[model samples]
Every structure is written in C-alpha cells, then in structure tokens.
Target: MQAVDQPERRATPTIRYFVRDLDAAVDFYRQLLGFEEELRPNPVFAMLYRGDLRLLLSVPGTYAGGHALPDGTLPSPGGWNRILLQVVDLDAAVEALRRAGVHFLDDRPSGVAVRQVLLEDPSGNPIELFEPATGYHERAR
Candidate 1:
C-alpha cells in the first residue's frame, strides 16, 4: 500500500466585472447563478465563488486609488467578452432565468455541437450558458 503525494491546487480562475450597482450585481450572481459570496472586504468590492470560478464584483470610478487609468478613463461594464458556463439543460435554465426577469441577448438557443444562450447580468456583463449536445467535444481528463 502506498499514498502518492500530490501538490494541492491553490490558484483558481477569477473574473472581475465592473458593476454599476455592487449590491444588485451581487444579488444577481448569488441568487440566480448559484455563486456563494466569499468576501466583501470593502464598500466597493465583493468576491464570490461558484465551483472553481471566482467572480469579483467591483464598482468602477474613483475611490482611494481607483480603478482608473492615468489619463482619467474609468473602467466600465458591458462588453462582448463573456464567461461560458456549462448547464445540463439549456431550455430549462433559460426558462427559469427568464421567469426570474433575467435578460438575454439572443432570442433563441442556438449552436452546432452545443445549445447556447447568451445572457446579461444586471450590469449588462454577458455570460454564455451552454448545454453540450451531440458532436460536442471536451478534452479528456
């Protein structure tokens, strides 16, 4: 009998979203998306996690050292870039979210190997939800 030593993985995937209203963003992610609030160290910031994904919600504009460029350009939300989340049932998920008053960019679920729906957070940050179908592929573990 032997026990093989393995290094513990500490680093996790993190995504920061500049939000208009921190509380609303927090609620949207926490309530609908299943993210658990991890930390709220300050008034303008919050950290949340769902599985291995760590989502950082931040209020843009001036603070102490602000998230602004040297030229005084403040960071803003809403962009084409998005985080993809896998779901078991795309139709059910979309229905539930829509019933909860969530917004979607595409009117219908569409994809080749996967059915997908692009949804927006309270601050308009895009998040893609996909359900793998026939011909879908993923790297072997």
Candidate 2:
C-alpha cells in the first residue's frame, strides 16, 4: 500500500471512423442512425456522435491528406471496413431502415436467437445491425 499521491488514470476514448464527405456522412448517419453532430472543426471535417461512440468525417485535402477520401466519389474504396451497431429491437430497426429507403443485402434472419441484418450506408459502406441473445450484451472497455 503506497501513499495516495498519484493521479487517477483516465480510460481511452472509443474508436472513431473517418468517412469521405463530411456533409454527406453527417446526413447519412443522422438520417440512418439518428446520430447528431457533436462538433465540426471546419467544412472539411465533422464529428458526429451517438452516445459515447463517435464518427469523424473528413473531406479531401484536409488535415492529413492520407486520411481524406477522394472528392466526388459517393463511396470511395478503402474508406471503411465495416460498422456494427447493436440494437435493442432488431425488427423495429430493420423495419425503420426499410421504410427510410435503406436497402439490405440480407434481410433479418429467421428463428435465430441472436438476430442480425446486413445493409449499406449511402456511401456503400456495409453495416451490420445486431440484437444479441438474451443474456449477452456488449461491454465497454
């Protein structure tokens, strides 16, 4: 047991994804996932947030050039791998997305304990919606 003189440690922040177009990404995330714009550094970059999770959108030729995506490309390659969001109600989420004109490559699975649906955003980046089994929930680190 040492003396209580050291400062407390802070937890690391959550991972943030960078997208191609700031405005388009903002629009897509806002409409699709109900994400709100937490901050906008400039016209080139914006931060959209949902709870503790954050997404960063950067336009071409801004900040780190390598991080910016190609201009005029709806969904540029190598921008994103995939994003997965857990939902409390899979059916409602799926139905809502469907009504919003979102297309899914695979519809909601049938008779599965853990329901899942696969779809893409406006930029063609894939996203997976998951409703875990009754006893399972994702824990934050």
lDDT, residue 99, model 1: 98
The local distance difference test score of model 1 is: 0.86
Every candidate's lDDT = 0.86, 0.68
Off by over 4 Å in 1: 1-10, 63-66, 138-141
Instruction: List the lowest-lDDT window of 10 residues for candidate 2.
Output: 71-80
Highest lDDT: which candidate?
A: 1
Tens digits of per-residue lDDT for model 2, 1-141? 877565477532444444566677678789878788888867777777777677666654446332434553332423436667878898899898899898787885643457788887765667778887765444422
Q: What value of lDDT does candidate 2 attain over all alpha carbons?
A: 0.68
In Å, residue 16's CA in model 1 sits off its true spot by 0.5
Alpha-carbon deviation at 8 in model 2, angstroms: 7.4
lDDT of 1 by residue, 19-136 (tens): 8888999999998988999998887999999899998888998462237898979988899999888888889999999999999998488877788999999999999998987545
